[model samples]
Target: MVAAYRFKPVVVVLLLALLLLASLLSLALGPVAIPLDDTLRVLLQRMTAAELPADQVLIIEQIRMPRTLMGLLVGATLALTGAAMQGLFRNPLADPGLIGVSSGAALGAALVIVLGGTLLAQLPTAVLPYVTVMGAFLGGVATTWLVYRLGQSVQGTSVASMLLAGIAIAAISGAVIGLLSYLADDAMLRTLTFWNMGTLGGASYERVAVLALCCALVWWRLPRQASALNALLLGESEARHLGVDVERVKRELVLLTALGVGACVAVAGLIGFVGLVVPHLVRLLLGADHRRVLPASMLLGAGLLLLADVVARLVVSPAELPIGIITAVLGAPFFLALLLRAQRRGGV
Candidate 1:
């Protein structure tokens, strides 16, 4: 019992250390290849006192740092949302994409990319990305709200209904995306394709700041839901009997998850499997207690994504692959395997 109490804080410390290591590695990596010592020096020179050579300064300031920080924030947000979703639904299969949010956000982003050049060009260039991000966030939230509404009824909520609604909404959103693609001109089509594929190439320190703010908000709300999540594990009816306020918990979790997902897909453009796979891995290693699982998910997700992004950069040498491709390559097989296992277990 003493060991059990001590373990959580120890694990949290270790995870934080791992995150710091991943952040340093991400900043150190890329095609130009700053040596680790030089990289550290450049970072220290920029953050503290001392002058650096122009070339090293440019590499650290103008290139890798923003992208690396963005990766850490994006990874943490997606993973936190994933942990929350799994806890809310009481299902290992639950993920951000499972609720139609990703499809909707992708559609919104594609629309903005495909059409914004002509329409939004009239507006200030500085305002365009913000407009696009707002559109995507709203679209994701809208679709998610619709799914929740469709799933709930006079008889009460059903997981099957929720899953079915999500699938239906996802199909509808996909069709919308297809239509948008068809209407797109050659340049717009190319842009949409690149955006859909997902890259951190567009990340800036400003965007990182915005993402961090959103993540901080979500993180603050999430830990308080731990007891609610624990009660949820007993099933909704039992949870209510245990004074869980099941409906309120569900609502809070849904909104928190949606906000986190919106922040993520807005910046990253539908990077897959972090949400789906990270929580499951966390549960497997750390157990299902939300107090532990939520924090663990954040660490594992950040590491997984940071590692994936590193692999993406190095895989093609000078030409970096899209981060999405790396994650899909890792996540799709695991997802399928989980689906098959669920079928065998009578849980699908």
Candidate 2:
């Protein structure tokens, strides 16, 4: 038991090291290159003395830091949400955006972007991301509520009905987004399209900091819920017999899922498959115990997103592809492989 317990922290540390390596690589990457040596010196100098040459400091502070932080935060949040969703619904297939939360967030962002400067101009410039973030959060929460209500009968939450409702809501919201797109001008359309594709190019420290804090909160709290979720695997009645509060656990997981998903969608703009991919990947490697699974997913997710972002930067050179595109391209093949393996094993 002790050896088993020790394994998770060991794996977490290894994954964190890998994520750190990828983040350093991200700093080295761009249209104008900063050599690894100077990048390290710049990063170290800023950390040690908070002072450096203007150009070096600017590259490290103004440019690379925010982008790297955003990638980490968004990555961590996506993975955490995936873990929470799986726990809540008791299905490996469960995901945050799988229930229309992502579509709802995207719709909210589309509305803001389509409205032009006039819509959000009154807000202070410093708070624009926060405004958009709030809109996305509310949108996700609203959609989740709708899904729950529509899916619930006297039978409580039915996964099938919830999924069907999500599909229905997503379809309607997507059509609305299309209608808005049709009316968009060239610049607005370009902006909306790019945003939908997802990039962290416009990251700011303030936004990254906010997202980091949110992800941190979820990571800290969610892992503690693992034993309870593990108990849930035995069926609700059995879990309740084991002194687990089934409804309370469900409620908490749902709330935590919303918070984590909201923070990620707010910043990352609906990057799919991380939630689907990471938790399952970790489960395959670490076992289904959420204790090990959650932390492993967080680390793996961060590494995967950083690697994807790196590929996005290099894939087209001077023109960066959206990170979402890279993730989807990479993840679709992996998803298919997993599907086939599950079929062979008779697990699905």
Best by TM-score: 1
Q: Best candidate, lDDT-wise? A: 1
TM-scores, all candidates, are 0.91, 0.89
Off by over 4 Å in 1: 1-10, 46-52, 115-119, 153-155
Clashing residue pairs, backbone N/CA/C < 3 A, model 2: none
Error of 2 at 11 (Å): 2.7
How high is the CA lDDT of each candidate model? 0.81, 0.78
Q: After aligning candidate 1 to the native by TM-score, how far in Å is the CA of 115 from where it should be?
A: 4.7
lDDT of 2 by residue, 210-266 (tens): 777667778878888999989987777889899998888776776667767777777
Residue 291 shift from truth in candidate 1, angstroms: 1.0
Q: Show model 2 residue runs off by greater than 4 Å.
A: 1-10, 46-54, 115-117, 341-348
Tens digits of per-residue lDDT for model 1, 1-348: 345455767767877888878777788788877778877887665444345456766777777888888888889888888888878877888788887887777777777777666888688866666777777777778888898899887877766788888888989988887788899889778666765788788788767776777778888998789888998888888889998888888877877777777777777777988999998887766678888888788888888788889899999989999999999999999999999999999986
Q: What's the lDDT for candidate 1?
A: 0.81
| Model 2 vs. true fold: TM | 0.89
Native-to-model Cα distance after best TM-score fit, residue 126 in candidate 1, in Å: 2.7
